[model samples]
Target: MSERTTFQDQPHRTVLLRNGTVHSPADPFATAMVVENGHIAWVGSEGAADSFADGVDEVVNLEGALVTPAFTDAHVHTTATGLALTGLDLTGVRTLADALERVRAYAAARPADRVLLGHGWDASTWPEQRPPSRRELDEATGGRALYLTRADVHSAVVTTALLDLVPRAREISGYAADAPLTGPAHHAVRAAAYDSVTPAQRAEAQRAALARAASLGIGSLHECAGPEISSADDLTALLALAAQEAGPRVTGYWAEAITSVEGAARVRELGAIGAAGDLFVDGSLGSHTAWLCEPYADLADGAGQRGVCHLDAGAIAAHVIACTEAGIQAGFHAIGDAALSAVVEGVRTAADKLGLARVRAARHRVEHAEMLSPELIAAFAELALTASVQPAFDAAWGGDDAMYARRLGPERARTLNPYAALLRAGVPLALGSDSPVTPLDPWGTVRAAAFHRTPEHRVSVRAAFTAHTRGGWRAIGRDDAGVLVPGAPADYALWRTGDLVVQVPDTRVANWSTDPRSGTPGLPELTPGGPLPLCLRTVVGGHTVYAGPNE
Candidate 1:
């Protein structure tokens, strides 16, 4: 295979993509697409492709590959994803010992002063049911520990060395009045770990992650750079990395608490407004920190702890008001029911206090309406709040008798995500991957949403596609993205199996592409036997940012 050329400047390059089945996500499903300088010039049958009568400069047959609007992950920590791509990965390990072993191996491979950064270790699922302590890692690293964080990013377990490097960590905040920096303070230590990384190293990590995302067909990502930890300079580093044109388009979001009038002004000065970054009303369920009305099912404490509310109602309302007053769009992380409710209340309070028209104009949003009651789902449309969620999370963990189920109990777990319910209730949906927590595989996300592992939450593939594409563009107020039609940005993904069909198996067994060692029926993984399907030849603004090797 020859290396594909990335055209930086268009020299009358009128390329015609013929015979491809296009999922324009528009009314049409299959049609020839014409590209002139990167934007779709026309979309119709070869007969109507005569619009290219100006004479095409180049012609390539799509060979019936699926040409769909490229996916936009509505929520992700791009810098974090990039770092994890090159650093240690502990995503699917079951025991704390297993996690420590991975970190120990990583530590052995590198020398001291070289900060050990890692992600994707979920303490909730581990039998230990708690994060690995700094002391445990201390032993693992031969007392030279500098391990940083778990997967949720909500917390971190740092060695004494790391704590010494970040003295502020000594004054950890956000826990009960008595406790030390063990909880959210660990998040601070994680921030310190990021500082240890050089700008060049961070950029390289970002580039590698973008390459991974491109290989999986993701063209754009919403980088949720939390302000509580990441300072303006951190965001600057990320933006500087993003400007490199290496892999995917990065849209950044700063944390809400830090989005002060001055901070909002700085972001505008930094040229980050009308883009990414927002506040968190609550934490995540994986951390058992999501603000919920009812408590965890298994917790012995009769009084279930409704999830954490990082921002008080007044602070949340005030911030929303401030962001709106400044004409900046905001996104809030709301996973649990109570947290979602609080954010909704905050938005409503902000609007009512500052006037609804003004708040509506700002279009400040709520991210991840993961566990919505029917009432809240209805309110999302009324409030015009954007439910930025990761569908793949549902397919992976929201299935029958899964962790989420055990946490929320059957009723609540079954209703988690509720895409069909939300859409039907008129909630505007936006899809994201929440990378490092989940894979940035756009097709897999679409597949999960389309084929709801629980079946009850299944949404049409078209709707899921729209949520991933158009919905994300709309969420960030990008009019040109998520559309392949003319006059829209020429951002799209070209895949090999656009029309591949899948049916629900009669047996309720997980499909593996390869035969399972368990020797169970229908247990072979559903692997595409042919060439890699859904390989991304992603193009943005007519520039070939990423192309599959097959090209």
Candidate 2:
């Protein structure tokens, strides 16, 4: 067998890439590129690249491929994603029995004492419209500890044994002994449920997730971690691993609600980029935990249950101000009108207290700005707030009859995820999968935004792609990435184009582009509901992270 090579074994090597259709408006005919000293040194025609390769350590033939800046997922839970990859994958489980059967099989395969950690359980789609009960889990596991997070990760069904570990869960407002714990109760039990996942397990899972990401042409991820979501050690370990390995780059954001300078110092000490990303202002719409101005249309009890507001406006303002004064970003997870309203008010308060320029310069962000009124959208634009959005949420549940419509009324549902409105309002939109909630597919995300359920809310394919690529970098306060240029970081992906079709902003049907003379070139036909480009290789900072099956 051939010996495997890593960047550590071969450092400071120059790579010459040629015979590729580079995606750059600056130089249309740029078919070759040079990566020297871990950065893009030159980009031009193949004829010019040969001369530059004279003193290079390696010359890579592109074999007539397409190259563009590698993708970056703005919001991701690395450990959760990795665990889902390696643990019980409950995605697409049609019936409750199927889910139980899978869990039973998974448990049998692994050690009995090992805590069963599984994700992606959506009862709404199940035949029974109900998840496996605690009794069912206990029966399946023979009293083993098991915890499965709902698709939204806002609720989870835990085995009695695991619930025993977090006795205080019963005191939580949304707690139930046999039912799926949601809101604060879910948060309380989650840590106890994941007690068995050691540092080694987390590292393994992180590697598994990053490897998959690299294979799919993703070069970076903004890890959304916090006290409620994930432990500080988990974030630190993942960051340390990324620094040491030739994997996708990871930027950490600690989402703990900051109330003191000591907390801010601790966040910095833990190597967090900011006190941002998933600092929950509210919960998810699917779980009915999203704080909304109006009560849910499908509420069985009454019209009183709007949702839960984990963080009040005062808390939001305090955290924002703290992060701003410390020259860091402060973000929150908001998905409803009420939560968005509070966020806007908090942002306004922070801006008033701190200078507007300082607030804008901080470039704070909000995750899942799903339900935004025109006024709120305008507020975001005026504040220069970064809308860290997930298109897959709309894709999975945004149609008139989908989950959003079912939860809220059709009229209210129609108002969700107004991608075009946000874009028109000049709100900086950053597209992410929020994976394990949604699968990590950039093309899917872009497609979802372009082909929005609400036709009027659809954004241009170009705009959606930009949001996924460029907006992601800006969300993390990194300007050196996202763009493909000599000065930009050497983070890009090579692909073999299946079909060439240029999708205009206004049109549904894509225009064909086979000839070089066609002013605009078609890199890959990401037509509505079509397969995305097949990645050939992914490169991050001049290091080969993933090579495709054929390569």
User: What TM-score against the true fold does each predicted structure earn?
Assistant: 0.87, 0.95
lDDT of 2 by residue, 8-108 (tens): 34576788888878776557668888888777888888788779878888888878888888888999998999999998988878889999999899889
Stretches off by above 4 angstroms in model 1 are 1-12, 25-29, 50-54, 127-130, 167-171, 174-183, 258-261, 274-278, 302-304, 498-532
Off-target runs (Cα >4 Å) in candidate 2 are 1-10, 300-304, 508-521
Q: Least lDDT summed over 10 consecutive residues: which range in candidate 1?
A: 519-528
Model 2: how far is 22 from its true place, Å? Answer: 0.5
Top lDDT hit: 2
Q: What is the lDDT of residue 265 in candidate 1?
A: 75
The candidate scoring highest on TM-score is 2
lDDT of 1 by residue, 138-217 (tens): 78877764755556666566677766676776765643322213345766666677777887887777778777877776
